[model samples]
Target: MDESAIRTQLNDAGYALVQVEPRLQGLGSTIRPDVLAWAADNDGVLVPWAVVEVKHRQVAGHSAALRQLATIRDQLGTVDHYVVIDGEWFRADRGLRTATPISGPVSPANGADGVLQDVSLATSLIQERLWNAANRRRHDGQRLDSLELFADLLPGSLSGELVARSGHTVRADRDVLWRAGRRALTAFTSQDKNTDLFVSHPAIARAVAELAGDAISGTVLDPFCGTGEFLWAAADRAVAASRSVELVGVDFSSQMIEIASSLASAAPVPARAIQGNAYSELPTDVDLVLSSPPLGLRLPTQHELLNGTSTKDGDLASIDVAIRSLRSGGRAVLQISPGVTFRANGEAYRQFLAENVRVAALIGCPRGTVPGTGTGSVLLVIDKLPPTKTFVSQLGEDWEDQLSSGGAAITAAVAHLDDKTAKAT
Candidate 1:
């Protein structure tokens, strides 16, 4: 984990380090404290502050560990808070002492960087708790709910949304829910959305596509239109522009079409969802095409799709056909396995895209962005706009911090192009 980034965010937020673990001494000892940072302020007189020890690890099962932390706290007289940061893959309570339950829970719905996001959220929550606690005895009844406090932060409409789209009763303030939703757009995995019937992280998909220049003026087609997610995202962008999208969705499963059509009817904008052979029956003359094609892992036979049989032929071919069918100047943004970026077999396709179309940009999504999937998958933003500007902005100096925002890279890429164009002129 990038500790420097975490320190940067904390320092900027008015936190100062009082001491770190290595300074306190203890390595290879049963308790390995990877992080030790603290904040304190003293007026003309000296004031006391708290000490925090951070333990970072991957995997799960931390009950015994927390018990160990409790023992350490007892040995060390004055300690404020002890925290444990674990990877998202780990089960709860596997790192920190079970005593201080990580108060602010930032689910994967927010981002796989939940562990890091949890840290930021934890800081704010600690302050809020202290502030509320000071007033708790004096206050009367029914304080402002979190949603009501930060109503402005709420994104889109919040009425139809549930805390967990899977029908879990975990309720949250509307503001928290909104932030959670935005995270969902970027962080949700296919598994996380498996139970979602209508609402999924549609905004992230739409935002990424729009940032890559998807629009309604062009014919936007979705190749692997699983329940018409990308099509609906495109439609939302179009509707926001006071126009309707000329959208078409193709799915290999009739069952998916049925569910997608029903979902679209309730969408903010109308879309056409159809059942067809995604790889074989894609419509031509599309101006902009976007898809999160099935990786074919859970399909009847993974080998069938990868090897490409005469009957099934495979969706990859369908995607290729979609690209070929694009109008001379059109572009397609396809989500593919990260292996596509470096795989030797894809060198031909890469060359084809670079020579024929402008290989506009390659965007890498965070790990676990599409859960239940393996390590290498990304959203490939290919355009016919020529190799103009390739924006690749650093998310932040905090290399360890989970990405809070995107478009920074896109902006950088665009700026890079502009510089080149200016130089040429």
Candidate 2:
């Protein structure tokens, strides 16, 4: 069997959570075991339980896999580490130079009680219902996508209302459904391949919130808010900073607006999501614009916010919506494609932006960080104040390290922006 098949087997055996290619750091470099499993602690919190490295029979031997597991053991400290060779599980020695054979099914304790594991199961179950709904409902001669189906399902499910459409009843219990729905949204995925949910990376969303500063109190807006992840993160940030902040998200998709609205209200901070075309009108009262707008897509000509802007489809057009919406001295932290950042296209608009907006900072992201997009990205931090010299840094895969209070990248970027803001003021 393949590595993925092995992971599934491990998960079935009682590992609450099983993941492949999990992002982890070893003593000095990255170490991605063939499979990683988690189990619940006393508090029902999911923690790393084991790392399984598979040495494929076709490809190689156990020595290399053993060495990698040894590194993980050294760093993670006593988390069970094992290597699978020829479909046999072997417990690795501390140094990994030696190992002993283990019994079959090396699953961790606590099968499904972990909070995250429960949530994952809930997501899977809910997703199954959504898929069934997709099979049932038809929209404009096409079935609604997974996200759209989720939006269609949430309200009725939450209200204890069931839909008897034409010939079928969507059986949903309020307690079981909405609770699962809320948790499911935390890591929701669309099974429908063609649908595009313009969501932001969680790490970048957290960074943007952190960069909003402790003094911030006015409105924070996400123009293309998908699922309200950024707003939720901002809410947490606001609570942490002890600031009274208003959060708003605008999306052209009504389904998105509905889901985002529910998500925002589900969190601690007060927030709202409105259905509006950002191209037509973005709220002008926004003090901070934190968004990851649709990349590589062109807005219709009339929606272009600035004069002399390029007609090309890229982040520049969506950024226009974000910048135009910003209040004076306001800040915008947005994701930009490399093409736009490098002036490969939209040079005219880039020039306009440079001349008019304060390009405060740029954070380069690692590959596969942004979901759905196969490419690495850059976070462009701009202010509505006068243009100034910019702060630039490349971020590692460990977002918490780079974006936290004392992290070099965030610290330097915040310092540069503050210095410029002070000078501008």
lDDT of 1 by residue, 70-147 (tens): 555454422333344542112233234443454322221121111112222222332333335335534855453332
Model 2 lDDT per residue over 12-83, tens place: 667645657655534354566677766666666555677888877678667777777776766655367777
Give candidate 2's TM-score: 0.60
CA lDDT of each candidate?
0.45, 0.68
* The best candidate in terms of TM-score: 2
Error of 2 at 380 (Å): 0.6
Q: What is the lDDT of residue 96 in candidate 1?
A: 43
**Candidate 1 at 41: error in angstroms?**
50
